[model samples]
Target: MHDLPARLPGAQRNLLLKHLPEPRMLCTMRSVKLLPGTAFFTGRRSFAAGVSKEAEPLKKLVYISQSNDVFTNLALEDWLYKQGDFKNSRALLLWRNSPCVVVGRHQNPWVEANADFCAEKRIPIARRNSGGGTVYHDLGNLNCTFFTSRDEYDRKANLEMIRTAVWDTYGLDLVVNKRDDIEWRGQKVSGTAAKLGRDVAYHHCTVLVHSDRSMLQKALRTGGVKGGYESKATISVPAKTACLREAEPSARVSDVMNAIGRVFLQNPIEDKHGNTVPSEAGGYQLLNPSDYWFPGLGSTRRDLASWDWVYGKTPNFSFSRTYSLPKAHNAGNNPQEHGIASVTVTLHVTNGMVTETEIKENDSFSQTGGSDLMHISALKGQRFTEHLLDAAVQRTVSAAMNAYPRGSSGNHRAFSPGPRLTQRSLIMESERNHDPMDREYVNSILTCA
Candidate 1:
């Protein structure tokens, strides 16, 4: 066994104690130990923690998940929103994901994020069931979800919980901005978003407790498409973000969680419609995201984790971009004798597939002997992406190369190297030499936003 450190810093000490059950109220609070592959739909286990001999009926409950998987947490949120018989009950879910980026339900991942960077880092991008700007999550982040009936849904009221909790616990004042975001000083520390179901509405916010700010910025970086990109997809509102850990060195995730829990348990809730409900000092339930505990939750989890629901749900969009191709020259005859040309592409994407494509060659290149334009029929019905488009062009170029060899006076050359091969060859070379920023632009346009 290892011995404890002689002394932990003040901040570290606070963090260690924050995770433990408050000694004064251990009898009221329940600590659930979750094991892997455990299946059982056991009803919420409620003990008489802090219950007076005449304790009033409980109107609200706090369900904290032991899991950190974003997909699992999202599935649990969905289940809670749809759970039948959710009458006067209120719930606060304290959760955090390992590491992931979640986009809004209607936001286009291609337009709102750097897919290549996220993929390289092995961080999955999720499209939550709510409509909001994209946000990044990791262990240092905390997710607090407040559930209320659809009739009594109030966003401002929820933000207040975060505001009051932080101020009361750490003496940190949080400014609730007009956008409903929690701000400290001038930087956004927490962002709020909500989803409304038929019967329930839940407002969930991301608390930047100790997130890697650099990684968060990198994951949500959406660059490129310099020429011009237009889409109906939701645009993200960039904010100067701050973390609780940055604000307070000793700040632990547990501290923030407990602060919110204490406020949720002790304070009364008032809706926008002038209805106030008081909650006693109630026990918070720690639950594991298990299908056994919540029937049909397994299927919900699968669907949320599926690609079709996430990427497939994006609305149709048009992608238009111009590609610069390399100069074509007959190396045998004045290899330097070449001019500039371009390929302008406008793709109409429907259901993530290119339904119609318009490929236009610029004035730099001209067809030979009334030669028809490169047949872009192959491009139709293809996945509207940059990589796929380049592949398609390469196929056409290969075919042209095979038909025509150099010294044929560019006759056999696919569209000949000059005006004939201008569009295809130029695009291929430029893409090969594309700068990282340019590649990001290309990736943005190629995607089916």
Candidate 2:
């Protein structure tokens, strides 16, 4: 945390110091100074002369983000947490994104999101600087971030402010659960997460107003097979989610945002003398996120949108897929040619890059050459992405086809290369085949997650 100047510029100092209550909060506008490693207070002494003086009354602000981009909004939060002075002020930031899946700082995007679905729909994913469960964000979902000094950081207080706002404005009775999420009739309508800093802290949460629940469910799931990905990343705790509009049809994102902002500013701020003081009401400021307003903010947004921070930061994990090779339909009743063969490919990934590859074939009748390993070795330093993984598998299968010419039973059994082995391929084939176990297999992966 950068040390505040001994005194602010004349105009700014007057603006901040004017809010201090007289007598108790004593200090002339020009005499105020902020020493390093000390709370913002007037340079005054108590009756004993050596005792600490009371600090100024807190000033509160409410800011509404003008941009809907997830990375830009996240950058605003980072800027406020790191640069904003919260010693005498508390701030509330309300924002909404176009359509994105936000994962926690310690989360794995591959495990928390459906890569194929996100890619097909073109919904970007972002990793926040807070540790919590994953969440889906859209224009209909309202995101709230409360900023305060580290000493005044309180997650419950922030949650209660939201709960009060919802109930008071919409007559919706919401309960704050043990996990800090606000529930409507036992279904979660809001989820909470927070980031703490040395001098500042912010608690952010998501409130579902009228988001697409179907898309939320599909986008939050991964395409990986069950028991395939093994990671130590923090997995999200699944919950039965509900939107505020579900109970109250008229509930709107704007109205809810206004209500929350109103409640936040209406609350009183206390001075160090235990006096309840009216909070400095800085009505909602429409924040246009840019480098002009917040220096180095563009860099922060870039980091949030970069691959190194998104997928490359994922914890080390391993994924294994086992699939059977379909035999030729023309091979009639010949047990030797009809042998059941399955191939299992296990890959160990570190820092979102393939570090190890293992391939094994369970063939009862014949054995193929080690040509597949040659192609698999190329994946050692490649990214553990669906596109790269698919390409590698296809190259391996293509090599196998060239090694043994099809329709030639002279040298060895004709090798039949099946569909490219991938998470999406397994899902599509498994579902199209209508195997009950296939359905169960896909659903079993997130049990541990």
Best by TM-score: 2
Clashing residue pairs for model 2: none
Task: Highest lDDT: give the candidate number.
Answer: 2
lDDT of 2 by residue, 1-449 (tens): 22223345767655555543332222222333222222222212211121233533455667778889999999888877877778667889899999999999988888899877989999999999999988999999999999988887888878999999999988999999999999999999999999988999999999999999999998997443235778888888889999999999999999999999999978776544566764456455566677755678899999999999898888888887664433322344443443224667788888889999887776542334454446666788888975565555545443433333234333223233234454455455445544332433333221221
My TM-score estimates for the predictions, one after another, are 0.74, 0.75
TM-score of 1: 0.74
Error of 1 at 234 (Å): 0.8
List clash counts for every candidate, in order.
13, 0
Report the alpha-carbon TM-score of model 2 versus the true structure: 0.75
- lDDT for residue 180 in candidate 2, whole number 0-100: 94
Off by over 4 Å in 1: 1-58, 222-228, 271-275, 326-340, 368-376, 394-449
lDDT of each: 0.66, 0.71
Q: What does the lDDT come to for candidate 1? A: 0.66
Native-vs-model 2 lDDT?
0.71
